[model samples]
Target: MAVAPLFGTVTLPSAHAQPEPPGEVVLSFPTVGVSPRLELGNNVASEVNLPLPAGMSAVRLRGVIRDQANLGAGFLEVTDDNGTFLGMVEIPPRSARPAPLPFDIDISGARPKGSSLPLQFLVRTNDIPADCGPAQQLVVTDLAAVYSGDEPSPVTIATFFPPVLQRVTVVAPTDADPSEQQAVLTLVSTLTRLYNPQPVQVRVISSPRGTAPPPTGPMARAVVVERGSAGLAVEEAGNPGAFLRVSGRGDELTAQISLLDNELQSLAQVTRARVDQSASHQLPTGDTLTFSQLNLEGRAGVLRRSTFNIGVDRAALGGGRIAGVGVNLLADYTPVAGGDAAALTVRAHDTVVYTAPLNASGRVDATFDVPSQALTQRVALDFEITYTPGQECGPLIAPMEFAVDPRSTLQLVRGGPPLGGFGALPSEFSPRFYVAMDGSGQEQLGHAAAVVAAVSRATSTPMTPQVVDVKAAAEADSGALIVANSVAVEQTSLNPPIGGNRSAIDVGLPQNLRADIADGLGSIQVFADPPRDRTVVLVTTTDAWTLVDPLFGYLDGLAGGWNDLRGDVLAAGAAGTPVDLTVRAGGSDPFEPPNVVEHRAPWLGIGIGIGLAVVAVCTATVGLLLWRRRRTDAAERP
Candidate 1:
């Protein structure tokens, strides 16, 4: 007998069968690093890069505006950086209960320079009120662009990637060999780095040996990886779109993937291309670097209070730990009025390092050393200026202007504790690192790819990985990413933060306390190998390998991936959220159960004493209540 399907499908009426209109895609300003709420003064302006996707047309710019200044007669103007007017809206006076005024301005006439639309927002007040406060401002917020169009299909290698992409799927054979797997991992890292801050989802899927990959959504692209004669080609796929096919054997496969990293990839404006060989250009490294060398721009502002950060990354020192840091700051500011006062303060990692008065010279040249305790993987040098206006606010008064020159110098002295944990990653593994996988084959390779890709996203520099055996990676003096099960990890000389067999595992907790967990657990731990003087990141599971999936899921969910991870280890069970375990120094004993039990003995005795006292008090109260009830019953009977 034939069985019906579990669910039934209903047909819609003919009226409802009409084709639906094209849907709108909303792109928020914050996605491109533009703050939704922009505070502007009389002549101040803010600019944002609105990425224009291929085949999509912008409908309008929509946002809310708050006119806090009560400027009854002014307009908020929108213009291109080149002074091309696009649109404008008049500012209205503030209401008694000021509500957010909504604006929907049509920007159909706006044209993009290259692939992005550079739009500037500014308020121009022709006359300033005599009684206005010094903090008068205009706030613009909740900004977003509405686009309506279908994504265009890519016909060449250059056009294959759009300005905005939701996801990219890398498809490989179900039984992919070592080379093909490595190529897949390389592609994941390369694409993730290229689309930094965009949060593009790069994933992998396995298909049959000689079959086509499953279809993808309009906003997503799929690239098929295979083992064959070397070449990178764009093949036509029916229905939705086309898929990129990259194929080669061993090293050739890797070289083909490297094409994505080349600036000349735009020259491959055809359907097919072959890369004989490819090489990556290494960035120049040294002890001292100027702000401009690190791609930092000078900050300039006209306000009572202004602050900016000068970020120095450890990776900029070529995978070395920071021993000392020195900065020669060059700044310029408007001279304080006769009655007004101003001061400049500098901080490293939020700790005040230097403070000085703003002199009449209108220039500051100060050199200072960063504190040792303030050092981290990424050091932030904050420069702040506070200006107090002495006179009543008026149009005739000059606004405070301050700036930090791009020529400011920073000197880094390398040599300190080889930082352990996630903070040391990406930087410590820079230039090149080794990858060692156990006998698990494709599954292990997939995990390695996830870890590699997550680490690559944390830095601007590209990291090269050489696949080697476990023994080679263990003995090498360079950083390594090791993916293995409990058995494999125990064999390596490298020590992980957490260790033991499947039946029982030693968990490193704070305050010299260690717990023995018998349940199946998976963990990702980072530890410094004192012998090799290198950092090692280990991914292992006590029992089931599937438990490791959640650990990676936790990492992927974070906006910063591995960069956001803290502590030394991340452990999880068969189900539930992963726990961030930090192993503190001076612990009673890391892996010794007897020491941990002894340490807890005092607390255990105190807890027993409290419980016994509570029980005795309850018993006495019950006995007295029963005796009183019996005496009252006897008196009533008489």
Candidate 2:
């Protein structure tokens, strides 16, 4: 099957066939993290980051336009950040019947800045009427880029990762050794994090030892992980594409894989490289970090209404749990003149937390505490400035200017109860974590890789993993991803939210209940290991290991991966959709027994009432039978 690109599907010639001529490839704006719809008013411009794959040239920008204000004569203009004109689409005046208008503008001469083409869009009117309502807004939707060219083949390690990727296939031996398995899982996490927000799919498949796997599609890449002399190289596959080989044994393998680290990968300018010695990358240290430290920069805008988010990731806390959070906000804005209304509102996790007038001193300096309920693995502090000019329509009206300082500080207090369920993860397992497999085999490794990849993609930081036995991981203080069968999970010290034998299972706490579910059932559960003060994620199934496939499918189907997962348990039968089960106020402690009284009260009452009704029915039947027998005897006597 052809790999799906950001916008549409493009099929390339097979590896064994002759190369096909270059064709048009469409990339939609929304797929690359940009809004496809643009709402522009007079004199306002919006910027979009357009990704142009290597060797591909931009052809045109196509979309539909909705002229809400009925501006009779206006044209939409496109320009680069450097003020270079790209092209324009003329907007026709409203006709007898109004409808969405189609537009396609040629931008063949556009050049990319790095891997992305930065372009600005604006709608200019030929004439502005004195009675123009609401400033004449134009809406452009379904914006996409049409590029012409085939993707370039990589000759160096640095260039192997293209600007756009759909899938990555990691090939390992059917009997891969522990080191090789570790390498595969590590690479999965690395690549997933590297191409986040792109919805890239990473699959692990096994082949015979020392045999190269089948070639991948044009938009996909294949990587071979095997144990051998330490090296990382890109070798020719006798086709347009090449496969990457990461070969090493034990620590040597880890050292070689480190070459793929985001900070170090760029140094590998050649097709092949060897790492003799390498140090692990260190995460940021400290309880307080500035916006700059968290990779957030100052944002300035000239719109009447502007908004931006300040994200605080738990991974930035160096793997520490958060007990409390505080933010010191620093901002500057144009003071509102008399009769003008302007205010700045701050929201944490979408709940309004703070508000202040923006008409004083042209600056804002304030500190506020974040509510505990708003805390998660990642917290978004949304800052929005709304300014209404005093004049409805006046030439003297000045646009609002708002800026957020990068020097703003976020203070996190460590040592809180491990967050409940999936919210605790990636953060709880950050910096370094353990993967404990019931059996260190290819199947187990594949499952572990999938779990790690999904979790890694949710965070901006890299999570290091060490493969060990179940006992070692369970005894360790750090969080662990445990992949095992039902019988194996039963033997561990960790308690899962859902547990039972092959024929019966007990769902504890909030979902307090027990049932005889003979069918195979798969489950992915998270619970707090209180004694160790760590989190444990358990992946297992009741009888057949094959049943667990759907759980992974359910996770993969989620657009947000781990972030989309909720509750303490995700359980499903062999042929059913996964269901999320929450433990509620009981905390996510698996050891906590089911709330028998609370969950079973209704059932218990029903059982008692049923018994009484059965007794009454039996009594009534006996009485009626006795009466009928007496009447029969009387009739016979007569």
Candidate 3:
């Protein structure tokens, strides 16, 4: 009939039908806040602070998923802080716990115009499915855009996360140049502030001969020299070296000298200044002198490049008969056009008095002394001038005082103290003359030291001025105890053959050691003078007694494993007797060995023999004793 419908086996629809999958993911509305601010040249910008609401959150995604069926194929793409695609995770089918979408973005190295990323997701599975209606397609237009600007873009303040700590120590040699010294100081300061590594204190001490007392009287004065006058082609003659001096007629005053290299860099600093004293007592008597060694590293430059101003204590030096005083400059250089013409002018107050042109070869046979007994009974010398290049003559600036009275006994002596010739001082430079206790006077000459402390109050360098007395218990035993302070013992003697004649050797160990000492000779004892000192102690012993050795190895065998002997030995010692031993079972079954039959297990044999014998003896002894005691008691009772 109609293809004979089969009615024998009929199947009906299930209780419920599978719902249709979502069509596409879409946002109800996409809105972007763009302020009225436009950067230069059609640039659009906005200042925005993004934050999530208490109960709501936003997620970013890439590559929209459209499903005509279940619409559950959407997945979220995660990116780094720079908006670079990192990874992606699938959107689970309609489920209770939905996977969270990632929102972080990284935009580093993007194109100049910038790009916007629109995201869409199918909401087939979730507590509240996303409405993917036809009008819900999300279009986030111009999400982010940046324009390159002429000025560097402003950098946002990053989180101030601190770094891990580290320690470092730096050592600077005394012979380093000034620039290097400065660099070291800077590095030390920076490290201290950054990590606070304990800094070691450095003390630089120098002793040069002579003395320099602070200038006295209103007329007493000092001279200061600075790098001056460059741009000349003169050669240094005699190279007497540069020096600073302060003196009066007859006797020379003492001062310190610092040498400079060709780069105008200070090379070495010397403090021995010996100025001649027995000179004429005229208006311009040269007396005190301070010398500083310098090596002008050959560098083409004009003088007067360096500048300095002499400091003066007017009230202390501008009184009495010190009136018109002058300062003299000296240089030792070969005379060329600009080099030979270089001469230093002496200036008193604002007036130039003495002018001495450097010699043709830059040698100084005589001092360009100035007279200063005019202005204020006591003169105050304060002047400034440039030293043109090429005049690397002897003593740069020599400030001297002259007097009319020839009966003056106040002679300028080089600083008498051991560390007097450092820089400017209060006294004058005297000849190397000393009054010997014997009826004889000889000249005493030596480099006096100059000590300057450049410590800051905030420095953390140790400043413990006194030696601290420490009190601690020692590790040595009493009664002729022997202790060793970082001493090592010879191993060969301690490890002779087992029964070999062990010779007694003095060692670092306890005096009353259990190991017999061979005639008080072979024994190595660590003797502690006070008997309570715990200094390092080294003991020499036979190799057979070591942990690796058989007899002694058991000691380590009991502790699971052998480790370094950083600590004291804890095993009990036997006085001429065998030491007790402890052991651990080796096999896995502990109760039985793998092949216990053909070869009886060691522990099994022990257990069998002792266990059966104990039973047999106990049973027999009890029966016999009971029988005898019963017989005696029965007889007595009856």
TM-score for each of the candidates? 0.81, 0.83, 0.15
* Whole-model lDDT values for every prediction: 0.70, 0.72, 0.22
Q: What does candidate 3 score in Cα RMSD to the true structure?
A: 39.1
List, residue by residue over 497-540, the lDDT tens digit for candidate 2: 67887757665534344545557567787878878888888888
- Taking the tens digit of each residue's C-alpha lDDT, what string does model 1 give over 377-473? 5767887887766787666766578878778877888775545767667777877788888866456776887888888777777777777788898
Residue 103 miss distance in model 3 (angstroms): 40
- Per-residue lDDT tens digits for candidate 3, residues 316-353, read 23112122222223334334345423444445546555
TM-score of 1: 0.81
TM-score-better candidate, 1 vs 2: 2
lDDT of 3 at 310: 32
- Top lDDT: which candidate number? 2
Clashing pairs in 2: none
lDDT for predicted candidate 1 compared with the true structure: 0.70
